[model samples]
Target chain A: MPVFPRFTALAESLPPTVPFVGPEAQERTRGARFIARLGANESGFGPAPSVIEAMEQQAGLSWRYGDPENHDLRERLGAHLGLAPDRIVVGEGIDGLLGLIVRLIVEPGTPVVTSLGAYPTFNFHVAGFGGRLVGVPYRDDHEDLDGLLAAVKRENAPLVYLSNPDNPMGTWHSAAAISRFAAALPETTLLVLDEAYSETAPVSALPDIAALADMPNVLRFRTFSKAYGLAGQRIGYVFGNRETVSRFDRVRNHFGVNRLGQVAALAAIEDQAWLSHVIALVVASRDQIGDIVRGHGLKPLPSATNFVAIDCGGDGARARTIMDGLVSRGVFIRMPGVAPLNRCIRVSTGPEVEIDIFEQALVEVMAELNGL
Target chain B: MPVFPRFTALAESLPPTVPFVGPEAQERTRGARFIARLGANESGFGPAPSVIEAMEQQAGLSWRYGDPENHDLRERLGAHLGLAPDRIVVGEGIDGLLGLIVRLIVEPGTPVVTSLGAYPTFNFHVAGFGGRLVGVPYRDDHEDLDGLLAAVKRENAPLVYLSNPDNPMGTWHSAAAISRFAAALPETTLLVLDEAYSETAPVSALPDIAALADMPNVLRFRTFSKAYGLAGQRIGYVFGNRETVSRFDRVRNHFGVNRLGQVAALAAIEDQAWLSHVIALVVASRDQIGDIVRGHGLKPLPSATNFVAIDCGGDGARARTIMDGLVSRGVFIRMPGVAPLNRCIRVSTGPEVEIDIFEQALVEVMAELNGL
Candidate 1:
């Protein structure tokens, strides 16, 4: 039968695709479960004991919708960040929030700027809204900030995205560099400063809340999914000038944020001691992963994020083989999607037991793939 | 202090208004919590005990993202509905899914049809996507199916929304009449047959799964939120022709649904005995609400859904006064937004304790407002 004949031209033109193939999908396709799940950059360390307790206590309250305004969590986040609640908007996740921001600025054929392979989910959102994406290839394994600014100016792009303590490549730029980049952009350009990894990054890497807090065009995105170990809860928030953040109120699914997510985030925020403990483990886990990969004859990149992206000697080909070999042996890891960065594989930090499994799996997979 | 300079014209033109003010927001403003929590139509009776147990059991697993495919839930739902898994797409909520479906078909200036004073969140999404909404007025407090069909034909609307066992007035048309309505629309018009109240509805009020399952132009939206009492879990699913269902995969936040929500829903679906228990309680609660309204010389609309809409024997102003009185006295209830429908106040069914509070509060509110 013919399909419903009138989907929008843009929706029609778009392909049926997902931004990432989750590990569960791979297990189904390959007919085996991965004992070690280090892909997807989820915090395998798990949420804090207090967050779990909060979720447990409120498990029966699933009958009530979450506070539509996400009132308490937003208030706490505002106080924590030294900003007013009006400046922050919590959402389902950074992925869901990114889609809303794209919808607000991107009409069909509008130009948007981002690095070639910084964050595919952001690009997926841009494409979903029919925005024309201009991807500046990474420079020195870091997002090409100057190049992104140049593209935005040339195209008069109203939207651009940059991730500090960047993903996939696991590299970062100094706070001063990012602050300068934000200043260089025309006020007409909205910059999505994704800081999903901010909790794990060096103190010098994140800008002070006041530095760009008043910039109407800058919205810094943060997530409890990362260092806070609540990826499964789908809680993330963005903040900027009150008026700019207010634009989201017009378009957001007001009750879209999950209920237990609010509980998890509130508990996670209050349990900063657990977060500090996790950050310490993450640093040590990164070094252990670096050592393991180095033993396998690959070079580990310096990382400010939870994951370490290691160069696998050859290119995307070798990285793919190693990744496939690891998966076949019940280890799940990921690699960057494009060239240069694609020569590396990324492994997320977790408890020592999972890291130990990854370390053993890597030795065998490297031997099998590289014919050691 | 100017706003972000380059939001799309449509975005800038849209008001920074949420479709519904949550009771939480109301409490925040009123500086007192409502003792009776019945405003948003959420199930105050809560989910199955098994569902709560499941959530608590998996509470620690929430550090991982939910399966992007929503694989296990879809498989179970497919079995329950007697359809292939590909026919179902699970999402954050029916609200979020409505946003996606509207985005797929409703480009700027696209004509969309809905009943006047229907789901405001759906209309919010239509306006967010720049669609022109053409609303057909309700007939005798039930959505005018014939009017909606005619409007779709008149405007050549690609999308139309109807909530069976309707909200606000809580009335429903017979299954045969609804099936005929779906059959009469041009194959081009996609019908969002929201069945959030299906579990509470009489068997005669629901079309069998096979009747509309093959129609590419028809999609039925069901939720764990309403009858299953998992409103806070934010899990809803749409099922139809496989091809149309697949369209959602293209735009949905694949990992957007929360982890524990999946566990909660899976458990809720399995515990049909508890569902029957809730439905029985809802029927009694509905009768209780009806009796209370009638005692006050108001008319309670006959309802197939879990809520009763009580007519205050006057106009919108009188109903608003009655509603405000109830809310001020810690009785949370909502009235329909548009005129005609606005003469009635809506109350959701809940546990006996909350129903008793509603009953007592209604008497006091009426006496205070109407000098009864």
Candidate 2:
């Protein structure tokens, strides 16, 4: 049958596609679950028990919609970060918030800048809004700040995205470099500093909340999904200048955040001891992954994020083979999507058992694939 | 500090306002919790114990992102509705889904059609997309289908919203009338048939899925929040022509729905026994509320929804005073936002304890407001 007749021209012209095919989809296709799930970069150590307890306790309150203003969670987050509540806007997740920000700036043919393979979801949102994308390929396995800046200037891009302690390659630039990049951007360009992995990064790698707090052109995204292990809860927040964050209120699904997520996030925020313990576990797991990757004769990239990227001594096709091999063997890991970076496979930090399974599967799969 | 620069002119022009204020916000303002939580139309009876158990059991697995495609939930929902999986799209909630649909159709100054006092979130999304709204006021507290069709034709609206078993007024049109209305709308005007309250409604009020299934311009929205009692979980789905539903894939946050919400919704969908139990409670409570309204000398509108809207035998002003009196005395109820409809106070069905509290509060509140 013919589709709805009135989708906007941009929507009509767009193809039906998604940024990422989830592991669940793969499992369904394969008709079996992966023995070790490391593909999505989700925390395998799971949420703090206290946070779980809090969510379970309030499970009965599922009858109530979450606060439309998201008042208490925002107030608590504000107090925790030493920012005013007006400076923060909580959302379904960074994914949902990114869509909102893209809508706020991108009209038909508006230009947006980001690394070619930095975050496909962000790019998907830009395309969804009919924005023209200017993707600068990564330099030195890290986002090319200078290149992104040049592209933004040339295209007069209104939005640019950079993830600190970045994804896929799991490499990071120093906070100083990021701050300089933010300062160099034209006042008209908004930088979306996705700090989704900041909880596990070294303190020096992160800018203080106040360092970029006053920059209306810079908004940093954070999520409980990382070290807090509430990825499934779909809670994330972005805070910046009060005026910028306030604009989100104008268009957001006011009651979009669920009741359990609000409670889970609030409790997760309070359990700082658990966060610290999980960071320690993440650090240990990253080291263990590096050791295993090196043992396989692959060069493990230095990482401040929860995952380590191991150069596979080949191209994107070779890396895809390894990724597929791991999944077929019931060990799920991911790799970068573009060239240069795609020469590496990314393994996320997880509990010891899952990591051990990955370690065993990696050796066997590599041996079989290489005909060693 | 200056705010972010380069927001689209449309975005910059919007007011930073929310669609609805939650009862939690009211409690914070009053410095006391509502003794009777009847606002927001949430199922105060709460989700089934089995549903809560499922959530609690899955709490530890909150580390994984939900399937971006929401595969299992969609497949199960498709099976439940005897439709193909391609015709269903699960989302954060009905609200988020509506925002996506509006974005797909409405550009700046595009005309949209809705009832004068229909879902405010729908209006909010239309404005967010810079669409001009053409509203038809309710006729006798029910959506004026004739008027809506006239407005759509007059304005050449590309989109229209109609909520079956409607909110705020709790009135509904029969299936024949709704089908006629859908047939009357221009095919160019996509119709959003919101059945968010469908489960609580009488069968006579709902059009057969087969009747609207093949209509390219028609989409039906349903949620686990109402009869299934999973509001805090934030899971909702929309179904229509396969081509129409597929359009959501281009822009939806692939991973927007939460994992536990997926699990909870799946379990809720399977537990028809529990749904029947909740439906019974809602029916009894609705009747109880109707009796109370009659005893108080207020006229109760017949509701096909889970809430009862009682006309206070006065205008919006008197209804507002009565609503405020209830709020001041620790009752939480909402009145319609627009006039004519605003002449009534809406009360959501809840457990007997909450209903008793509402019954007691209404008598005292009315007496105090009328200076008895």
Candidate 3:
């Protein structure tokens, strides 16, 4: 069949592939579900009971579209952050919001800066919008903040993405270093600070919300997916100067955030007890995974987020084998896609049952790989 | 404060104001909620009991992100629509999907055509992407099909939006007329045939799926929001030529669709018995609204949608008066924004209680408008 001939030149030139292959897609190929679902950094602990109750109550009200303004949630988020509601804009997820930000500023050839092996979704959005990406490779297992800042200035980039408590490597920078990087960025360069894993990070890892609230060029992105266990709901919010944040209204899908996500996020925010409990669980699971990796003679990196990245004592090829072996043994986990970082396999903190499976599977996979 | 200095010239120039001021915003401003929430055209009938049950059951599993591939929903949607799974792509909702399509095809200076008072959300997406809009005015309370086609060709528009079983007016074109329009459009002009209200439309008013399936340039958009009563879930899917549909993945937020939306939509599709029952209820409610409008000597357009557009036998000013009066009386309803069409008010079909409040409020407001 002849294809439609109306796609923009940029869209037509794009590849017909995605950054991440979902576990379900793999399951379809493998013809079996993973015995342990710890691959995607989701909170296997799930959301609060109050959040489930809130969703159930709001489910019947599903006939009505969510408030386009996302009023109540923003107000609550503002109170919690000590910022005004106008400074916050709630969106589908950080992924969805990233796409919008990229669209707003990125035209063909607009320069963007990010870590080389950081979040692929941010890079995907940049490429989708024709932004020129300049990647600064990680130094010492952390996103090279100085390198990224240098690139932003070198390219005179309009946009830059930095994920504190970074993913894939399970590493983070101190709040002071991150704040310094933000301050050094040219005012013309907008900083997209993705804190999707913020809830799972230590207090020292996150900048005070007010610290960046006054910067028109910096927007902090956070989500309910990690510590709150609401990844399936696709709710995330961005906060910054009112002027920059208000620009979101010019392009956002006004009613894009679903009704249930709004209610669930509201309830999750109120249930601080659940959040604290999950944090403890995540801490324990991280430690447990670290112990197992160490016992197996693999080096586990210190983690500030919900997942740990373990160095396999070899290169990407060896890491690939370990990942494949684990998958074959009924474990589903992800690893970085690029060099250097790809030498490590990333595992998310989950329930004891899942961690136990990963522990058992890792030992067997290691023996099998050694035998091979 | 000076806004972010790096916003694209186009982004900075776009207006801060939006087209539709949601009722929730109004209630917040007025410090009160509306007694009859009839303005947004939501299904007060609510989702199927089975769908709510599915969502409740899946609530605890919110740890996992929704399938980025939307594998199961797309498969089920393809089976339901008689298209290949590759032909269908699901997103956050019709609103979110519309943004993707606009981004894929529209760049600055691209002329996009639509009815003068058609869905504002589509126009918002177009403007957000800097598309030049050419709006064809409605004729005799219906989307002027010929006018739209003429504009599409005259402007060499790359995209045109046609909502069969249209919004605000709730009027529909016959299946034959719709098919003819689709065939008449130049293959270069991509048609966004929004069928969000298709489930509530009479079968005769809908084109055979296979009839237009071969047209690579014509994409039909559908939603589970209307008859299925899953509006809060924010799930909508679009299907067309496999190659054209595949372009969505090039730019869409891979995980924007909520997890429960997938579960709810799958269950909604499976619960066809409940869908038929909602159809019956919507049909009855449409008649009930018509009768109530006629009792006040108002003219209600024959509708193939879940809402009835009542002609108030006056100009936009008078219609505004009646609408504002009803809103003040705690009844929420909407009217089209443009001339001739704005001479009528639109009300969505809901349960008897909401309909009763709307009916009673309309009579009292009309009497006051007439100085009775």
Candidate 4:
């Protein structure tokens, strides 16, 4: 049969990749479910009881389309962030919102900058939109603010991404440093400050909302997926100057955010006690993971977010071997994609049960690797 | 503050309107909630007990992201449609899927065809992608098949859309007529066959899945929103020749579909008994709505969807007056945005209570309009 012709030249040139293969796909290939699911940085601790109740209540209301304005949730978020509701735009997820943000700014050959080992989904969006990606390598296992700013200046890229308390490497810089970096960027550069892990990071590591509130070019992305345990709902929001944030309205799927997600997020936000509890558990789990890494003669990078990146004390190939070994042994975790950073195996903080499974599997995988 | 300076020329050219002025937005403007929501074609009958149960059960499991592959839902849907799983790609909703299809085929200045008074969301997407939309006006009430094919040929449009059992005006074309239309389109023109209202549509109005399955350029979109009462869940899928459907993977937000939505859709598809029940309810509600329209001295168009579009026996002004009167009485409904079609008021089928409210509000609105 003849195939449909006329896919944009960009689409035709793109490679077919099943990016960010989920643990489920890995499990399907391995023919068994993993005992530990510490990858993807999802909160294994689960949503609060109040959130569960809210979801149960709203499950029937799922018949109605959610408020296209995402008014109620945005109002609650604004109150929490000390910003006006118009300054925020809720979306399917940070991934979904990032796609819209890119679409608004990126035409073919538009230059976009980010750390070499930053979130691949953001890069995927950049590539999907035909943005020319300029990646700067991390400095000292952290997203190098200086390097990213330099690249933005050099490329004159309109869009640059920075994820503080960054992923994969699980390292962070102080709020003061991040604020300085934001202030240093050229006014033409739009900094996509991804704060997906901000909930689990230390207070000192997070810049106050007021610091970037006046900067029209700086938009911060946050999600309920991390500390609130709502990744499955795919609810996230981005906030910046009201004028800049309003641009999402032009392109976003107006009714894309799930109704139950809205309910769950509202309840989760109101349940401060639960968030505090999860944060504490995350801290403990990170420490536990660090101990296990040390016991294996690996170095665990100090983390502000809910995950630790353990240097496997070898090269990228060795880390891949260990990750595969862990998967085969019913443990699920992830690693950075690019080299240097790929020398580490990233494990997310989760409940004790999964942590125990990870600890046990790590020992077995090490023995199997060393013995072989 | 100076806004982010380099939004694409296309983005800057777009309007700042919220676009979909949802009922929630209406209520906010009116300073009150609508007593009845019949505007969006959402099933006021709600989802089945079993689907709700499935969502409730999965409510606590909201910590994990849905499978990016949408493996299980696609597999189940394949069995239901007699197509291979590879032929189906699930997304946030048909609205979202439409956006992807447009992006895949549409470049700036690309001509895309749809009925003038058809789904506005599809037009919104086409505009967002900088596609020059060529609209064919509805023939009588149904989307004009001949006109669409002519537009495609005339402009050599790479993409053309047709929604059978159409919206705004709840009328339909026979399956045979549609099959002919599909066979008639140029192979280079990708036809988006929107079957969102198919479940409520008579089988005679639906072409057999295998009839169009072999055509690489014909993609059919279906959803759980209208019939299955899962509108808020935002789960919809598009199916076609596997090769054509595969393009969606290149640009789709892979993890955009929510996990509970997957659960709800799986259960909704399995609960065929509930689907039968909802269809019966929709039919009965349509009849009741038609009676109300006649009582108001209007003519309800023959419907193959879950709503009735009643011609107000005057111009667009009369329809607007009645619709506004209904809105003031807290009866939520909608009408087409284009002329001729805008002469009608559209009401979605819902629960008995909402139907009763509509009936009462229509009588009051008529009396008020006549008195004035």
> What is the TM-score of candidate 1?
0.99
Q: What is the lDDT, from 0 to 100, of the residue B295 in candidate 3?
A: 93
C-alpha-based local distance difference test score of model 3? 0.91
Give fnat (model 2).
Answer: 0.96
TM-score of each: 0.99, 0.99, 0.99, 0.99
Q: Candidate 1 lDDT, tens digit per residue, B190-227?
A: 99999989998999999999999999999999999998
Docking class of 3: high
lDDT (Cα, tens digit) per residue for candidate 3, span B256-343: 8899999999999999999999999999999999999999889999998888998999999999998998899888889989888989
Off by over 4 Å in 2: none
The DockQ-based CAPRI class assigned to model 4 is high
CA lDDT, every model vs. true structure: 0.92, 0.90, 0.91, 0.91
Residue-wise C-alpha lDDT for candidate 1, range A177-272, written one tens digit per residue? 999999999999999999999999998999999999999999999999999989999999999999999999999988888899999999999999
Count residue pairs with overlapping backbones in model 1.
0
Candidate 4's displacement at residue B87, Å, is: 0.2
Task: Kindly report which residue stretches of model 3 are placed more than 4 angstroms away from their true locations once superposed.
Answer: none
Weakest 10 consecutive residues of candidate 4 chain B by summed lDDT? B11-20
- A best-first ranking of the candidates according to their DockQ comes to 1, 3, 2, 4
Give the top-scoring candidate (DockQ): 1
When summed lDDT is taken over every stretch of 10 residues in candidate 4 chain A, the lowest stretch is A10-19
The runs of at least 3 residues in candidate 4 whose Cα sits more than 4 Å from the true structure, single-residue gaps closed, are none
Q: Write the per-residue lDDT of candidate 2 for residues A69-143, one digit (tens) a residue.
A: 889999999999999998999999999899999989898899899898888899899899999989899999999
Docking class of 1: high
Colliding residue pairs in candidate 2: none
